[model samples]
Target: MAPPAGPGATAAPDAAMRALSSFRRRRLAMRGAAPPAWLISLATVTIALVAWIAATQAGLVKPLFLPRPGSVIGAFSNALDGRIDGAPLLDHVLASLMRVVAAFVLAALVGIPVGLATGLNPTLRAALDPFIEFYRPLPPLAYLPLVIIWFGIGETSKILLIFLACFAPVALAARAGVSAASVDQVNAARALGASRVQVVRHVVLPAALPDILVGLRIGMGVGWTTLVAAEMVAASTGIGQMVLNASNFLRTDIVVMGILLIGALAGAFEFGMRRLERRLTPWKGKV
Candidate 1:
């Protein structure tokens, strides 16, 4: 063939270079089109920190009441360095986490089965619905005195309080989930010679999983809240205890640290639950 009419005898090299350039341009455009979510989050945090620092520097707020971020960071570091009594920050965090997990597990263990039975069976629902309705509205802390009397002012009492807080929500959610199972699915399973147990396992349980997970999330949050209250009663070690101690000393830094720590921990747990829910319910549509 007579050489191409361009500078290069052939257009192949030019086409390849153009394709590569286009790809690079596209990638650059994509990168520049939107800021990463993490960057936005970091920017937000930076803005908050700057605002706080400015407020403190301007003396708009008292350091005693609202210490500078550096002070909080220093206190946190000091807590890690064994400046505080009792235990390190990690220990306190671990202790609180342990109690919350144990209580939540106990709540799930007791509540799920009760919910299934009550929800699936008319007679059981009739019998237990009244009690559930009665107690669900009542605050778990309100029964702390009775729980302590029954279980003593020890781990058992605290765990029981958390369990009570978590249990009602789980049961109610489970019951709602079970009841919400599709009638068509149940009938199809029945027609296929599946037993009631099979129907529940393959149809009801799978369908109800989303609701159950939602319940678990809500229940865990309640359990965390209850843990703090329970720990306040007679805890020797916990974030709750830390807050109580800080309050006694009027160490607002420590108080703020304790509150922040609880929020951070709760947020961590919530994140974990969300991941778990996503993993388990891959087939379910997003909420």
Candidate 2:
């Protein structure tokens, strides 16, 4: 039989076992660690671009269905020189951007307050909820004719269509965000002699900010999607208009170019909103 170990002898072994366990854990953690998100995104984009080039070169897909990247670039150059439908790319971009930005700003200005009022006052919520909910699920195209009849096929109708598209999501997000603040926090604010307005301004708004930002992001996406439909209202100049014209003429390369431009713009907006969210709601996931 082995001799009994002393207390000091066991302590050394225990220390070694702990060191071995820690080393194993660290090795496992290192092996399981994911690569940086940006690297993964880059790799994904690179692979997609390579696949697209290879597919086009291999004639697996016709140029009509998927134009070569060089053809799309040529279309882009033509757009810049006002050769594609005789309007410069800047003109189309600005028209669409102005309409989208205007509608989004208006929606945010109006929706946030209405959402707050409905969230705080049951009477207001009861009165408005049915109307909002009734129309919320309806697609913008369903009411396009009505909008044109009421407002005419002009800028007003176009902006209004996009506004209506953006409003519901922002309002609902703000309403839902109102519940994020704890009862304890509200009570604490009230107990400290904060007025109703003060409590809301300080506590409620901050708590709901994350959700509001999220809503804005969602609303912006909806606005972009609605842009094409909105610009369809007798529009002569806009990215959507350009794409529509290209489609009509079977200018698939121009169509592809316009699509890529719109996607790039929307992606930029998404990236901006994400940065803003991180800046404003640093404590978002921490809690």
Candidate 3:
């Protein structure tokens, strides 16, 4: 067999080594080219700062109305230095975050079961559909007065407002997700002697997770929007309170800072939710 084909007869080792080297080089190149998210974020901030500076210098807007980027940064620094009342900016952020968490948890706890029941039972859905439709259309802020009256002008009222804001979206999304589940999958589970609970646990919940997460995301956004309105009622400390107070003083720098902080917080919260969704539902396609 020609001495069992000497090393010269086969270039597989050399080819394999070249292929491995090529893969490593490609990987290193990709790593070098991958843009950092922080860098993109910094670029966005720099662009906004440049725009603000240009506008201020060109006399396109009044300082009292727009303020310079430097002023906003100064306000942020002052806030950090304990120049403001009712705790620092970070405290306000944490307070708002805590309220959001409380409200979201409350909404999820109640909404999921109601949604499941409504989705599984046509009669129940028919009975509750009218009420849900009516409430879902009504803005949460519009009901703030009534909520305050019922729950008092305390944390309860604020939390309830957020809960109401979150609840509608979550319940609606859950119902939709459950209804959209594949009938074939359900039937197959049944054919395999799976009980109703088993089918729901093994098939329905998993399939509906993506939709449920979507609803959660929407609900959280709505809740954040409602936060300002809620704080406008009886809040002593929060970013919303900061914005409202700044408006009274005509401190445009603080107002702008508050607004930017709100947006940043909302974006951060949404990003976290997206990450959580990815982790929980790895089988789902990337957003």
Candidate 4:
């Protein structure tokens, strides 16, 4: 064994550590100068609004292409009062919301089970993977004609299109997340006298919950993205239909209004899902 170091050596190392700690504190202080996320978001929004107003109000962009904020607001008011088209804004909003919610719920109800089963059984996954992979990458618009021909240009076709868009993401996410449940955990559960069903219900699901929630969020987004295409199916009262009508009439303000409304609604739903994910998976992202 070596003898202990003298005070001089210890003093040098202690000074170096103290200097490193000071450097870290200084770096943290520097980082503290950055604004909070919400504040940055607000600032970004403010800048965008200012830019939009300046571009439109100062005639940098044509009203035909990009209407002024005031024009859009007036269009919004007219929509609210049912002055733009025969139907009121509430009708359009409700129609779109109903279609999206129906499709998303159906996708979750079907896809989640299939996904779980696929994860639990390699044979099932092998059997299903080909079909899922073949169609998942196809754009919704590509099959719109086939769906219309099969289901007719009715609400059924619209919801089915949206459902197809949502189903793949949810199913794939669930399948991927199933691996998060380790073999050790499964074995442990079995050793504890847990039934197969109990092992899955208690162990697999909790571990996979985060991925499932992520899939739901992604599926919701895809459903909304397909909403416009789905609403193209002889729809008369949905927001997508309203936007189509506005475009035909060269009503740029109304088109902008519809786009903004769709974005706001989607954003609201996304925020709600994030909150739900946090609530249900409090153990997520922790050590």
Candidate 5:
């Protein structure tokens, strides 16, 4: 190459080159040796709390908008002492859980079988797909009025609303699971002298289970989301009701606490469902 650059150019380039190399090595080290998932999760929570504390201390965010963590904790303590709303916090949580479990069971009882039938029979799929597709995208709020009008402001209406919220996801998941089943497995079962029902019961159901569990997880999530809307009816005892009742009085601390409680419960449900899936479908993704 040419002779060495002037002293100024030479110095600048040498420093820049060293800096770039160090940057790249640091990046590679970090990227190649990622922390475990739990560590990452913990880091995320820590970062959020640190940010929250900073914002609260700096007064950048209004208490009305985002209550302080200490305020939320105090609200939680109050809830524990049975002063959150008209009833104890556990009563509200229990009421919401009862509604969720009842609605989920209803959806599973109906939607899973219907979904299985739709995938098993081309005719049924053709007949039901349109109806399922139409309602699947509709939000729970849109149909709550009709549900309330028909069913009155009873617990039945609330349960039905959550049930509908859960139904389409569960049904569609089961249908997808059945569709994803191996044609080879079905053919082999038939070849081995299994009857149609037996093949469906044994070959198809097992193949579709993992997906069905996934759908159940999704359905349960939707059911929880629908809870607030469902409890909009003339209701008094539910986590959703507590949130709404708190917001009516501008109790941001209570609102934030309720939101966190709901989020924690949802995460727990998701974790439990994942465990159940692993236990039941241990052969997932295997050839």
Candidate 6:
């Protein structure tokens, strides 16, 4: 209804939009590039370390609260040599790893099948959905006391805590993966003389594996974080206990070292899971 814009006005707006679009494209490209990922990660760690060093040297933060990097290194050395708590750090790491392995393996065995069944059967889902939904949102700390009271302060209790923390994620992930299976593929398998069980085993499971792996990763993370709370029950020889013990004495360095060790272990698990996912689900998203 109005007069047409002048060439000059249209050109300026068009140029500005083009520039913005180009900038966005470049940013996205940079993010998607693998080389930049490592570079940025390294740069981020370097910046954090430098800032921490600066803060410590400038005495902006007390050593008792946040020890220097060198102090943490020394604490790590002591832990390795069995000088801290008169136990080798590897012993603590192994103890924690054992609990995680036990809980995670059990969760996978039970949760995966239950998840797959629920995905295939609406009746089963209706029956079990409320139970999973009710507890999934609750944190480990919320139910930890009840668990300890029921099971007593023992290894069983600790493992059970970790199990509870890991179960919901793995089950939900497997179920979601099942849902993601192509209906066409399922029907084709049925038409090709595949039984219900065979169709699920061959078609649905393979299709859902990528999602199941993702759920396992999340479950592992939850289990790892729940370690601290789990070890709170009559614990003596795990990273969580080590951190808690050091905190009692204001041993900030040891606490920080323990935290780093936990982070490293968790990161290692995540990396390994990602590799396993790629290898096991080569056909992911291809269908």
**Residue 252 error, candidate 4, Å:** 1.3
* lDDT, candidate 1, at 101: 94
* Model 1, global lDDT: 0.86
Report the C-alpha lDDT of model 3 over 33-129, residue by residue, as the tens digit: 9899899989999998899899998999999989988899998988776586557888888889988889998998888778877888899999988
How displaced is residue 201 in candidate 5, in Å? Answer: 1.4
| Overall local distance difference test of candidate 6 | 0.92
Q: lDDT values of the candidates?
A: 0.86, 0.94, 0.88, 0.95, 0.93, 0.92
RMSD of each: 9.1, 4.3, 7.1, 1.6, 8.8, 5.1
Question: How badly does each model clash, as a count of residue pairs?
Answer: 0, 0, 0, 0, 0, 0
Residue 198 lDDT (model 1): 98
Regions of candidate 5 where Cα sits further than 4 Å from its true position: 1-32
Residue 168 lDDT, candidate 3, scale 0-100: 88
Clashing pairs in 2: none
| TM-scores of all predicted structures | 0.83, 0.90, 0.82, 0.95, 0.87, 0.87
In the range 156-239, model 6's lDDT, one tens digit per residue, is 999999998899999999999997788899999999999998998899998888889999999999999999988977888999
lDDT, candidate 6, residue 88? 94
**Which of candidates 1 and 6 reaches a greater TM-score?**
6
Clashes of 2: 0
The TM-score obtained by model 6 is 0.87
Q: Which candidate number would show the highest lDDT if scored against the true structure?
A: 4
Writing each residue's lDDT as its tens digit, candidate 5 over 94-184 gives: 9999999999999999999999999899999999999989998999999999999999998999999999999999999999989777899
The residue pairs found clashing in candidate 5 are none
* lDDT: worst 10-residue window of model 5: 80-89
lDDT of 5 at 85: 80
Model 1 lDDT per residue over 1-287, tens place: 88558766467888999999999999999989989998999999899989999999899999888888888888899888668745888888888888899999998898888888888999999999998899888887788889888889888888888888899999988898897688998999999999989998998888888888889999999987876788877787888888888888888888888888888888898999999998999977754
In terms of lDDT, model 2 sits at 0.94
- Residue runs of model 6 more than 4 Å from their true location after superposition: 1-35, 285-287
